[model samples]
Target: MRFSRGAAMVALALMCLPGLSMAADIDGGSLSWAWGIPFAGILLSIALMPLLTPSFWHHHFGKVAAAWTLAFFLPFAAVFGPAVAGSSLVHAMLAEYIPFIILLVALYTVAGGIFIRGNLHGSPAVNVAILAIGTALASFMGTTGASMLMIRPLIRANDNRAHKAHVVVFFIFLVSNAGGSLTPLGDPPLFLGFLKGVDFFWTVRHIFPETLFLVGSLLGIFYLLDRWYYAKEGVLPVDPTPDTRGIGFDGAVNFWLLAAVVGLVLFSGFWKTPLGITIFGTEVGLPGLVRDAGLVAVTFISLRLTPASVHTDNQFSWGPMQEVAKLFAGIFLTIIPVIAMLKAGAAGPFGAIVSAVTRPDGEPDPAMYFWATGALSSFLDNAPTYLVFFNTAGGDPATLMTTLAPTLAAISAGAVFMGANSYIGNAPNMMVKAVAEERGVAMPSFFGYMAWSGAVLIPLFVIMTFIWFR
Candidate 1:
């Protein structure tokens, strides 16, 4: 019933979205800080509601998300008129939200279908190995994809351990965030840069060093932590679903389907088309439309070919993806003003932010870019946060590639790495948290998780600044 209701709400929002409005002409200069209140409210709701009242948050999170979205839209419509409101709504949905959810769903569905059949005995070495593999895989299949694929197995492997929260916590650090810094395919922020004419190899060439530093350091820290925990747990619980046989995969076909999804994503990036169709005032490109269609088909193919037993083994359900879809619907909508304000740069209300990225000498400071980009990405969606900084750094691929290279690299690294600071910072962080909680691992609250990342990640970032960005 809740799913149906959420579906209806989403459908109505999409349908009501119309194009051409005050949003197109209105500069972010006119918008005030107050416009960002709804967005802040929703994120705060996400952070506090779970800790303060889990049952209420669990039951009506969708409603709360929707209400916050309406809080922005209703007032904006009244003040700016329906056309401006509709234009922002249409633009956000067509340009950002749809593609974002499509990619997440396809990856989640395909990865979830392929489950590891048998679990290994949890040892410090074994746990570190899994984290390392997942970290590496993240650069290829995406942080979200690698996380969904590896997290369940890791959880099962460590199920008998006395201390397990730290495992999932470190997984978010290494696998779900930092490991994705090396490639556009690995993380959305870099991928957005790629679509904006940043070279395919740009991230690999520049950000790879930072990625290695962060990922390598985190892995070492995790190993030490896991080793200590293993020594403390002198005895193991009888493995309920022990490895009866050697490790093997259950749904091999879904991997091909996953490959197809990846191919479609790449195809859209490389293949541009002049042909486009207008849907509800939004311009839809043929390449993007086809790619989304192909992804939807790949999702169905994964479902059809993969056995029911496979999904059952993975304990797969649509709940987590749906929750993301509904909540992000609200987020994407409410964030329109904030994005516009940032885009306004020095002319806009957030001019201080733009000014802060530059030194008095007029050179763009890479360290400040890293910290500022990271600070915003820690709260807002990292993809757009990256674009804001990328544009602030001149938005020229050639110049940014050569002259302002460190700035771009810092932006890329900050967007990907600091996303681990909060669950809502990246979609996968929340997904991992939700899944771990579902599996009986008591994941930390949103703020609690921040405490962990604040303690562990911030110092590393500071060290990285002195080592590289400086």
Candidate 2:
């Protein structure tokens, strides 16, 4: 029995495992050969993060944790490759993740520098008000739009305040992430669910209970924190001292421009819908139009319409967004090979994982998928991470509830709501950070932001687990 000690021991342990499936068997072909490369890549990037941003690493252990995760998963790409995968991983990364991340940075930089004009005294209350409004708006305007509109004011309100890192951290949890749970328009993952034939209104209905729970709980917490901070600092509420220069609604043009962009978004989603499209010499659809329109709108805002004075008032600059854009762009390129591998190995490589578990109701279990997909969404491109889960959830009888509708509801809620675990989880989060920095509220770095989530948000999610999922 000990003839081949270590190797044999490993083989025995693996085979004896419960629910072990054929997916674990590596054929040693192209797919098997390609496995594990992504894990290495992730590890390398994580290791390099601290080296590159030592000061950031100093207080942000959470960033270091994420870096380690990146390191660990990078190799999984090699284990996961082309022959076993389905969609082109490059398309997922580029078409899904990169553009949105870039857009967030650009919007944040522009708004942060130009529009933020409030003082820091009343910022906490304003931030709470913003989160409340944002949660409601998420259902209508989309979390991205609402976050973009509110983040600048939040930053401006807190501009004169120090020791407010917790404020922005909690802001991400409430307004950016948890708030978008109720509707397809609120989050991309839910939107993808809508495109996949799930009833759009179903998610909105089922998630209402969960949304109310989170909102009520978070707002209470935020108020206590806000009051405490205000009292400790002797901060007074600030009023927006009116500018008597009497420019009649001309400055409000930005609002109109912003609205125009929203209209374009709605039209693109409606017209070139995932239902498919064929246009002059090419077939383009939801993805195509969205990418095109989003870029066009952002470009117009960044390059053409934003007046010099607005930037001056908001303290806007291009650097933050550019940095985020560059980083995520690289991420988009690097993750393609990995995702491709995962899909390629779907049947055999991850078969065991895919098939091992079942829900309490004896349906196909989606918890693993939810957690893995969610973990990635928190750090990488949330949209693609979202799609990956949505795509994975497709066609699985086990993932559904007793009825088709409940199953879809579950998937949509998980994808949209949980995506807010990290700054990168939602586009608005990073923008909020850039805006905060522009207004001089020193926010926690990438990982530092997570500590706040781990402590506050994770527990809240546990309550949700029992209340909703259970």
Candidate 3:
């Protein structure tokens, strides 16, 4: 569904509200911890509902999200008055959710249009090559995009194999999660950091080593595992969907659009201007406006220019995007009070969280931040989880990128990397599983996937904590 125009109209309507501009700020220290319950409720809904009641969640996920949003807002208005609630909603929408969703839609739409044609034999070497390529592309096109683009071809390549579930599992590990650690464009958590005024290159520059360690280790492990499987199971006598043509790309025009997407994101980060407008309590910068508008143009342009056949081959639909949009809309709203409480620091209700991540010298502990952010991100939405720790670490981007750089790196690396710890850790983890299952891969169950991650990924994270986060 189209969101840009609707988002703009909502922003415009909110801007016109009479008293919202003068609303007082949320008093996080004064508000009890109960304000965070709606946020917890929504996150729990996201984590459990799908696994426990797939059919009901599939049909009514949006309604569930909306219910949580109201669960927060109605009580919030009753307690704090409508003006405060209105301004909070406006700020969350204009400053955070709208910009976030726009970039995702642009990437999703453009990337969906470009399909990789032809197939290769799923030899261990060939499988490693595909995973390597996907890992590299994930930093640019996003994990979701790279996962979608590469999964089908990889599946086709391995369809002739007797035992191949491990292949998809490693695919989730390398392509869908760890590969996206290096850039804001790569994953939702890093993007939220960028939106919070972290530089576009901050993550890549800071966490490249961690990303290399994780991705390289996972790839190496997968290669050895795949080789053993190939030796044991051997290939089917007849290849399913045998290679008919040399591997090449279709809908190449989207490459230009993808480049445009990158350019827009970078331009917004680099271009600073005093020019901006105030909508309710939020400041909408001119460069941000231009960047978001450019993304929307690129999205529709890809849809228009790419051949319909290309989209058909890709099995592209807006269902996933719609689901992300609705769920995150609730998340961004419910997270407002939570962020405020976090910003309150050691004196706030969440003082224990601060104490947990802080050293005796009053310095933030990188190791604690790493595991704390990681442990929560394993089950909650990584994007908001990142935001939670971000504000917890004082919510000052300048300080975060400088003296506290290691702590920032820890948080970033944790949210992105530990997302592979569970199927629901990142959105793309489940998407990859669903696609693989549809293609006849006997994918692991939810707990089964966790078993894989616990075995493979947890050990690596432990080693990383000692090597880097310490």
TM-score of each: 0.96, 0.72, 0.88
**Candidate topping TM-score:** 1
Where model 1 places Cα greater than 4 Å from the true spot, the runs are 1-25
Tens-digit per-residue lDDT, 54-121, candidate 2: 67743453343334334433453344432222122223333454446544543343333235443434
lDDT-superior candidate, 1 or 3: 1
lDDT of 1 by residue, 1-470 (tens): 35335544654564565544224545788999999999999999999998899999998998898889889988987898676777667778777888898899999999999989787877888888999999999988999899999999999988887679999999998899988888789999988888888888888999777888888888888888888888888536577566667889999998898789878888888887789887555677998999999988998888889999999999998878878887887888888899899999998999999999999999999999999999999989999999999999999989998999999889998999999998888999888888898888998888889999998999999999999998
Cα deviation in Å at residue 314, candidate 1? 0.7
- For model 2, the stretches where C-alpha displacement exceeds 4 angstroms are 1-94, 97-120, 236-250, 272-283, 290-298, 301-303, 341-353, 360-362, 366-372, 396-402
lDDT of 2: 0.55
Each prediction's number of clashing residue pairs: 1, 37, 0
Q: What ranges in model 3 sit over 4 Å off?
A: 1-18, 161-165, 188-202, 228-242, 379-402, 430-448
Model 1, position 130: C-alpha lDDT score? 94
Q: Candidate 1's C-alpha lDDT?
A: 0.87
**lDDT by residue (tens digit), candidate 3, 368-400:** 999989987886678878988898888899999
Residue pairs with backbone atoms closer than 3 Å in model 1 (clashes): 22-84
